[model samples]
Target: MDRKGWVMRAVEALRLATFKEIQRYLDEEGEPFSKKELLDTLKALVAEGLLEEKEGVYRPARKKGSAEAFRRLFGD
Candidate 1:
């Protein structure tokens, strides 16, 4: 998987994670990502409604119909 995929996987596995936690998970998996890269990816994910953030903590947004909406809108 790519870095973004890994990021999503890490967040999904953790359910809720801080920036450092996501970074650590990626590093432990032998895929060290730059801080800017991770943050940028997270920002995009949040914008796409694939993820959510609160007080710098991040989590996958598990809302019904959201995935379908995203696929329709973004053609994922």
Candidate 2:
């Protein structure tokens, strides 16, 4: 998939997004979006390697390293 798709997937998987949850996030954000845009974005993210599937569940792949440093330094 393209880079935009990859980025979206990374965000989704990192966030462990379900389809409906992702849709709801977009919806409740109070911005306007067409359903097609949301779904297509998700499908593209799935095409990228940012998400992993386990037992029918999808979550963002864990980045290797320490969040401890990040947390101490930047407070996320």
Find the candidate with the highest lDDT and give its number: 1
Cα distance off (Å), candidate 2, residue 51? 2.6
After aligning candidate 1 to the native by TM-score, how far in Å is the CA of 4 from where it should be?
1.6
lDDT of 2 at 2: 54
lDDT values for all models: 0.92, 0.57
Model 2 C-alpha lDDT versus the unseen true structure = 0.57
Candidate 2, poorest ten consecutive residues by summed lDDT: 2-11
Clashes of each: 0, 2
Expressed as tens digits, the lDDT of each residue in 1-76 for candidate 1 is 8767989999998999999999999899898999999999999899988899999999999776878879989996
- Candidate 2 per-residue lDDT over residues 4-27, each given as its tens digit: 454354456447656566556555
Question: Which residue pairs clash in candidate 1?
Answer: none
Cα deviation in Å at residue 23, candidate 2?
Answer: 1.0
| lDDT at 2, model 1 | 79
Local error of candidate 1 at residue 64 (angstroms): 2.3
